[model samples]
Target: MTWPKKYGGQERSFLDRYVVTEEFRVANAPVRAHFTADRQSGPVLLKYAADEIKKDVLPRITRGECCFCIGMSEPNSGSDLFAASTKATKTDEGWRVNGTKLWTSNAHHADYMIGLFRTSPSTEENHRHGLTNFLVDITLPGISISPVHNMAGLHEFNEVVFDDCLVPNNHVLGEINGAWKQATSELAYERSGPERFLETFYILTEMVRTLGTEPDNRSAEGIGRLVAQAHTLRRMSVSVNGMLQAGMEPVLEGAIVKDMGTVWEQALPRKARDLTAFTDIGNRTNFDRLLRYAIHIAPKLTIQGGTTEVLRSIIARGLGLR
Candidate 1:
């Protein structure tokens, strides 16, 4: 929602976008078709892409007709993004990309991928200096996607391979081999969003439904603590959105929000299960099913956007403790 008005975005305040995002998440809306583009890719294009690229992509994104997948982690990379070895060699026509991106979400259905690839050799003095960001057309030749299902038997994740895939010079985002400068700012957008905490919100809703208005002391206390935690996280997330709107990179604040939010969300299923242990078995069958699915999906929450350990390190560095 931060794109310019000319680009078909409403140019709404970040807080307005925050409200919309929270409403969608709480309602369990099927937003996966446009979530990545709306949340991170659109802002990235606005800030870094050329006018032509923005003109071509932003409107489609705003129309919810395009899907984007991030290509940051590789087989050996994961949270250590600097360890990525996917290569993009300069060619007479444009650039030739060859590598495999592991654990890329929605790659199978993505219209585009904002890929990070190695463009030069990393020196000992600056290991992060050699990477570049390219907006790859997923339908291009030499690009292949294979499904990598999660524990829930869902096929949302994938492995994408590039073999001499051609990326035009104009498709390069920001400066060549200077993507590191653009990365942290992008992550500030990615990590501070309401999605971090709201993924498991269904479990909390189910818990409340099963408990009804009047509850025992333990159940009430558990519900109160969960609600309080959710409120605190929403406050933190909204504050970061304000910072983003003000044109400041609140990397530390974003990291803290994601770190805490993801941990809480990852544990929410178990917490809800415990809180509803004494609920009438007859009324809890649906709750039990939702809780089971949440449990299955919980492990990936902390590891997806960024791992807990990596986020803690970022927060520590921001606090001058690392």
Candidate 2:
């Protein structure tokens, strides 16, 4: 909704996008197919890509014909993107990439990847330098994807390897060695979303349905608290979106939203287990299966996008706490 009309966008407001996103998330729609493109990738290209690239790619994304994935978080680097060692050497033709990206969600299904590769060594005085963003066609030669099943036995994550993969010079997004500026601003789009807090929302709805209209004091109180927290998160997330709509980068606000939202969502299953322990909600809508799935997937929520520790460090530095 934020894109211009010529790029195939409706030019709708951010609040309009937020409402649709919230509904799809709560209804558990199969949005992963285009979620990355709709959320951050399209916006990234809109901001950093050349006019020709945007004209070619953004409309495809708007038409739901393209998918995108992030290419950060290498082995040993974890959330420390500055420490990434993935090399992208400049060649006579274009660029050759050689590295492995771990925990890449939806790489197997992606048409393109907004990958970060080190084009030069980091200087001692400025370690954030030398990293560059590239629009990688994952289906290109020398690029391969391997599935990394989660604890829930889901193939949502994959490991992507770049073995002398050639990327055109035009695919080099923004500055060659100045990706640090871009990455921080991109977080505002990545982290401030309803999905950050609503992944396991079904469990809560089932809990309420199981308890019926007249829950006991304990159950009612717990549900009330959870509802309040969810409401607060929604407000914070909406405010961040508003900031983005106004062309301001809400980096710190976005980090805080993800940190709090992920923590709350991660703990939801445990709390549901404790609160519903005495109830006989087993046969109602496969609560047992849903709970098991939530529990299994909960561990990775905080680690995705950005880890809790990394988020807190950003929050700290933003607030002058460091």
Candidate 3:
């Protein structure tokens, strides 16, 4: 997929291609459209960065030469996003980053990483201050990446260690330590994507297949509910994308979609657990394995980018909070 020059481009989104149920389009189509460039790490490079980064990153993605990953979370930090311990110190050479990042998807294969770190200490509340972002190279000498075996025993994630890694002065994103503002924008991008909820969607497609010629009430009802839910969530997701395109931060709505969509993905297996025997161990528990995958991965959906609790905090504040 060629990367878009501007995130919220005037051209129709990439997701316009899929023939999804109309409802899904309303809830989350934009997310599906910008899953890669718009949703993940693309924005920081686009918004806070200079033109050179864009020039290199854009065509590289179009040519399939660039891969991306999130660099947040560690053994101890999960829900307390602001509590991350990774430190990036300013040095004459640039910034020397040293710390470990956990559950980093695509870490093993990605060419660049958008890392979260403490550039200084908080001046305001502990939540505010000292945080920053950097576009780091995985091939740098001080970096080490190892895969983390998952539920299906799949090597999809990795543990990334940065040992005094060097990031040139230009690599610093936004201000010296003003990432909190930047993070608000980045989280909106991360939380609004389709990947959060579509990881195990193949099961639903399989259910439609297993029903064969005519699905009974249970099968039809089950599939219909999922299809409808996917539609609704998708529409909401698309709206978020539209908002992002407008250069507005739809953080609260994005949280709502991720929290709700992930819940629905988790529910898919439970709703179909008894509808089919294909869930046998040999079949990867079509339900059991997917259920396992969704469950294990589900927590990360909320935790990744930002925690569900943190999202609620944001939402609650929107309702009325100090």
lDDT of each: 0.90, 0.91, 0.69
Question: What TM-score, computed on C-alpha atoms, does each candidate reach?
Answer: 0.97, 0.97, 0.81
The candidates, ranked best first by TM-score, are: 1, 2, 3
- lDDT of candidate 3? 0.69
Question: Model 2 RMSD to the real structure?
Answer: 1.3
- Quantify how close model 3 is to the true structure by its C-alpha RMSD in Å: 4.9
Per-residue CA lDDT of model 2 for 18-109, tens digit only, reads 88999998998999989999988898899999999999999999999999998988996877888888899999999999989999999989
User: How large an RMSD does model 1 have?
Assistant: 1.1
lDDT of 3 by residue, 1-322 (tens): 2135453233444344222323343343333322444345665676776678777675665455677787877878767666778889988888898889998876876888888888887766556677888888789889999999876666767999989888878877788677777767667656766665675576676666656657777777777888999888878877786787777888888888777877777666656555664423234445455455544654444455566677778888877774
Strongest candidate by TM-score: 1
Q: Which ten residues in a row have the lowest lDDT in candidate 3?
A: 17-26
> What global local distance difference test value does model 2 have?
0.91
- Candidate scoring better on lDDT of 2 and 3: 2
Evaluated at residue 266, the lDDT of candidate 1 is: 94
* Candidate 1 lDDT, 1-322, residue by residue in tens: 7568899988778889899999999998989878988887788888888899999999998888899999999999998898899999998999999999999999988999999999998888988889998898899999999999888999998999999999999999888888888888878888999999999998998898899899889999999999999999999999998999899999999999999999999999999988887788446788888899999999999999889999999988998997
